[model samples]
Target: MSKKVLVTGADGFIGSHLVEELILQGYDVKAFCYYNSFNSWGWLDSFPKSLLDKIEIFTGDVRDPNGVRTAMKGCDMVFHLAALIAIPYSYHSPDSYVDTNIKGTLNIIQAAKDLEIERVLVTSTSEIYGTAQYVPIDEKHPKQPQSPYSASKIGADCMADSFYRSFDMPITIVRPFNTYGPRQSARAIIPTIISQLLNGYEEIKLGDLTPTRDLLFVKDTVKGFIEISKSNFLIGHECNIATNSEISMQKMADTLIHLINPSAKIIQDTDRLRPEKSEVFRLFGDNKKIIEHTNWKVEHTLEQGLQATIDWFSEAENLKQYKAGIYNV
Candidate 1:
């Protein structure tokens, strides 16, 4: 029988894409979506009915241990992607980030230990490394929690590691740096720019264009997750899914404006700027660990990924989902 996998946060941007890809690969998939009043499945609701039919949707909050346990009951593997990821929002309400990111992850691994689940991949972020004391940051780099969101993720990562060291649980912390693609939240830099330009804003609003990032296309990041899961060598270790390159916000904005609207210009938005100390100025990740362990490689270049994202946002149906006129966080 094909392995049944439970993907927590499967209703989210990266999570939805992961679910679609997993189903296409013939895994019996259970999508653990955050429960909601409108019965909305986040981006998963936008998926074609044919693909939607193939998934087992489990509606529950990851913060609840009982709910997480119930969701993992029949699954052979677990991909815990549920977390409050917005940095600005975390600043406003860090308690929620703690309850969800740290505690939610604890629930998953704690249950996994009891259930004897074969594998557990806890999703992590590149922000944990802060400004990158060294270029091309590897898994061994000291985790500098720059924001409450990153701090919560750091706590969560530690919790997973404790479970691994104490009980020998099969766990791997999969960290992806600056993933961008279709269905990304407008809170992110790429989507914020794309949404405004497509919506006919001549002067695009932005903040902190000097910061550089190692952008990985969402599909490439997803491929990293799958390939890493296939490797027994990665258990109890952390791996970064990255392109091993870097780009500045200014250059990235120029490219997007060139692609969508040449007439557009960047307009500084004070509200969008991160606090001086909190902002992560640079993030260039080391991908050697994942490369050494798995067959994954970058299938999308920066241009290819940006074009794909722009193409998706240009569509009337997709573009309408984002409100470019207001700040997302």
Candidate 2:
């Protein structure tokens, strides 16, 4: 029998892609999506009916400890991806971030320890590093929580670490740099730019153009998770999935503008600007650890990934889902 695995937050962007990839790799997948009255599973709802048939759907809130434990009962391993991730929204609703990111992660790790799960991969983000004090940041780089969202993720990462050291539970902190692709929310720069331009906006509204990011395609990010899960060397360690390259917001926007509509221009929207202290000015991650430990390599270049994203968004059915006119917080 194939190893049965549970993936929480399988309804979200990266989570949904991970689920699809795991299924393709022949794992018996259980998707724990956030419960809702509308019977919606976020992006999972968009998957072809044939693909959805292979998945076991369990709808529940991650913050509920009992629900998380129940979801893990039969699975050999679990991928914990459920959390509040929007930086600006976290500033306005910090308490929710504490409850969902920290407490929700606590629920997953605590349950994994109790159930003696074979493996547990807790998702981390590059945002925790804040502004890179140095280039090509490795696992040993100092963590700086520049925003409330990053702070909660830091707290969650520490909690996962404690579980490994204190209880010897099998766990790995999997961090991915800025991931962009189809189905990404407008809160992110790539999707924000794509949706606005596709809608024929007069000016591409963006925030501070000075910050730089190490962008990773979503497919590559999902593959990194699968590779990490297969490696015992990654247990009790934090690994990054990145391209080991950087691009400033201005340059990225200019490139996207050139690709989509050459006549379009960019205009800074004050509402979109992150607070100076909270802003992460640079994030260029070192992929050496993941490369050394696993059989993963970035297969898509910046142009290739951007083209794939634009192709997906160009679909009329897909583009209609986003409200390009309103600025999403």
Candidate 3:
């Protein structure tokens, strides 16, 4: 029998990809998709039938402790990837972020502790290291919570660390910086650019083009998770799955435009702009820790990843799901 693995948030962008990869690798995959009235599995619905048939999906909310505990039973490893991730959405309803990101994570950690799960990978973000006070941000860099989303993740990371120190629970904090690819929600920069360009928009509306970020392709990020899970060196460690590279939003948008539709021009949209002080000005990660610890390497350059994402969105079936004109918070 394959090692049983439970992946929470398997209905979202990265989570769905991770599930497919896990199934391909022969893990007995159990996907925890959020329960919804429409019975929608979100992006999980897009998986090929061959891969889908191999997965055992359980519908539940990570916010519900009883539900989480029930799903965690009999699983050898847990990948906690469920959370309210959109920064703009967090601005309007921070309480939900607290409930889902903080309390929701708390429930997972507690369940892992109770069940003595061998490995628990709690997902984190570069947003925790807000506005990059210094270049090449590392694991030791000071954390500044600029948004409610970031604040909640910081709190969650702290809680995960405490579990390791206090209870000797095996946990790893997997931080990925600005992950983007196919199936990504319109709230992300890459999808926003692609959607607008695909919709035949001449002028793309955007915000804060000056800010720099270390972009990690979704496949690379998912591979990083698998590597960390396999590595003995990563136990109880906070590892970043990132390219030690950076790109400004303007340059990134320009590259996307040139690749997809050269006629498109960028227009600043005030509504999409993050608060001045809260904006993560620069984020170039130092990926030496994960690199030295495991054989994982970043396979896709931003250009390659962007092209693949654009190709996916170019499809009428895929493009129909997104609203390109509206600014997604």
Candidate 4:
């Protein structure tokens, strides 16, 4: 029998892709989506019927230990991806971040220890490193929490590490930098740019364009998760799935403009900017650990990824979901 896997936050961006990939690879998947009054499963609604039919969905909040325990029952492996990820939103309501990111992760870790799940891959972000103190930031880079979102993640990562050391829980933290592709909300730069351009905005509104980031395609990020899960060598270690490259916001905008419409002009929007000191000036991750451990490789180039995202947003059905006029937090 194939391994039974439970994917928390399976309704969201990368989670949805991970679910699809796992199903393709012949895993018996249980999708743990956040429960809602409407019983909606966010992006999972967009998945094909055949694929969706194969998944067993458990709807519940990660903050509730009982709910997490129930969802994780009988699953051999768990991929915990649920969290409040928006940096801007984190500033406004940091308590939610702590409860959901840190506490939620703790619940998962504790449950995993009790259940003796074969493997657990907790999703982490490149934001935890804050502004890169060193070029090509590795797993060893000192963490500087520039935002409450990153801070909450750092705490959760520590909690996972402690679980590994103290209880011998099998866990791996997979951190991906600036993932962008289909189903990505407008809160991220690439989707923000594409949504505005597709909507025929004459002057694109943006925040500080000087900061640099290492962008990974959503598919590449999903591949990293799968590769790490299969590799027994990565247990109890933190690894980054990145392109080991950098791109400025201004250049990113230019690249988007070149793809969609060249006439779009970029304009600064103060509301979109993060607090001066809190903003991460740069993030270029080192992928050496993940590459050395498994056969994971960068499958999508920046141009290829951007074009794929552009094509997805270009569809009228997909474009309608986004409010292109407003800046997403």
Candidate 5:
């Protein structure tokens, strides 16, 4: 029999992709999606009928311990990907970030400990490192939470570490740098650019184009997660899945513009700009640890990945879902 796995936040972009990948890898998957009155499963609902039928969907709030515990039952491993991730939204609602990211992570760890789940993977973000103090940041780099979103993730990481040290619970922190591809929310830069250009917009509204990111494709990230879960050496450790390369927002936008609409221009929209202190200036991650520990490698080049993303967003049905004219966050 295959190992049963539970993936939290399976309704969102990366989470949905992970679920599909896990299913393809022959794991019996249970998806924990945020409960809503609309009865929507977010991106998970976009899956094909065949794929959707294989998943066991649990709808509940991650912040609720009871819900988390209930969803974790009968699963051999847990991938905790649920969190409040939008930095701009976090600035306006730091309290919700605390409740969801920190407390919700606490709920997962506590429940995992109690249940003695074989392995638990907590998702971390590149934003936790803030502007890189040094190039190609290793796992040992100092964490500077420049924004509330990063602050909550930092708290969550500490909690995961505490569980391992204090209770000897098995946990791994999987830190992914700037993962992008199909199904990404318009709030993200890549999708923001793609949707606008595909929507026939002449000007792309953006902010702070100088900040750099170490981009990773979603497929590679999901593969890294699966590989990490299969290895016993990564327990109680943090690892990053990155391309070991960086791209500035301005440069990335220009590349997309060149492909989609060469005539389109990037416009600095004041509303889209982040507060001076909250912006993450640069993120170039070192993937050496994960590469050494797991059977993972960069599969897609930036050009290839961006092309795939553009193709997905170019679909009339998909492009219609995003409001290219307005700032998403």
Candidate 6:
């Protein structure tokens, strides 16, 4: 029998891609999405009918322990990816970040412990490392939370660590750098850039052009998750899925603009700028740990990833979903 896996936040950008990959790998998937009044499944609604038929959709908030526990029942493995991830939104509502990111992760750990799940993978972000203290940050790098979103993730990582130390639970925190690809919302940098250019916006509004990021394609990130799950040697550890590369926001925008529209100009929108102290100036990740432990490799180059993202957003139907005129969050 195929191992039954439950993926929380399965309706989100990275979550949806992870779910699709899981299904293709022949895993019996239970997709846990945030419950909504309109019965919306977010990006999962875009999946083909045949693919959707294979997934067990469970709609419930991660903040609810009972709901999380119920979703984990009968599942052999759990992938906890549900969290409020927007940095700007975190500044406006830090309480929600604590409740959802930290508390939600706690609920997953508790349930996974109680249920004796074979493996539990907690999704983390490169944002937790804050500005790079050194080039090519490794797992040993000091965590500096510059934003509330990163702060909450740091707390959650600590909680996951506590569970591993106290109960000897099988858990692995898989941290991926900036993952960009299709079905991504406009809130992300790549989507924001592509959406505006695709909508015929000659002037793109952006913020913090100097800040750098270690960009990883969505497929590479998904492969990291799967490789980590299958590796028994990685229990109770944290691993980073990255390309060991860095790209400044301005350079990234230039690259995207060159690919989509050479005439487009970037304008610094004051409203889009992150608070100076809260901004993470650099994020150059080190992929040594994940590479040494797992059979995972970066199959997509940065150019390949960006071109794919641009192609997806250029489609008339996909481009229309985003309001390119407004600053998202």
**Candidate 4 Cα misplacement greater than 4 A, ranges:** none
Candidate 3 residue-wise lDDT, 1-329, digit = tens: 88999999999999999998898788999999999999998898987887788999999999999999999999999999999999989888999999999999999999999999999999999999998878798998999999999999999999999999999989999999889999998899889988988889999999889989899889999999999999877888999888999999899999999998898888888998888878889999989999999989999988789888988999999999999988888
Candidate 6 structure, TM-score to reference: 0.99
What's the number of clashes in each of the models? Answer: 0, 0, 0, 0, 0, 0
Per-candidate TM equals: 0.99, 0.99, 0.99, 0.99, 0.99, 0.99
Q: Which lDDT values do the candidates have, in the order given?
A: 0.94, 0.95, 0.92, 0.94, 0.93, 0.93
Tens digit per residue, CA lDDT, model 6, 108-143 = 999999999999999889998888899899998999
Model 1 earns a TM-score of: 0.99
- The ten-residue window of minimal lDDT in model 2 covers 320-329
lDDT of 3 at 78: 96
List the candidate 2 regions with Cα displacement exceeding 4 Å.
none
Error of 5 at 27 (Å): 0.3
What's the lDDT for candidate 5? Answer: 0.93
Q: Stretches of candidate 3 above 4 Å error?
A: none
- The collision pairs in model 2 are none
What residue runs in model 1 are displaced by over 4 Å at the alpha carbon? none
Candidate 5, residues 1-329, lDDT tens digits: the string is: 99999999999999999999999999999999999999999999888999999999999999999999999998899999999888899888999999999999999999998988989999999899999999999999999989889999999999999999999888999999999999998899999998888888898888889999999889989999999998789998999989999999888989999999999998898988888888889999999999898889999999889899988987898999998888888
RMSD of 5: 0.7
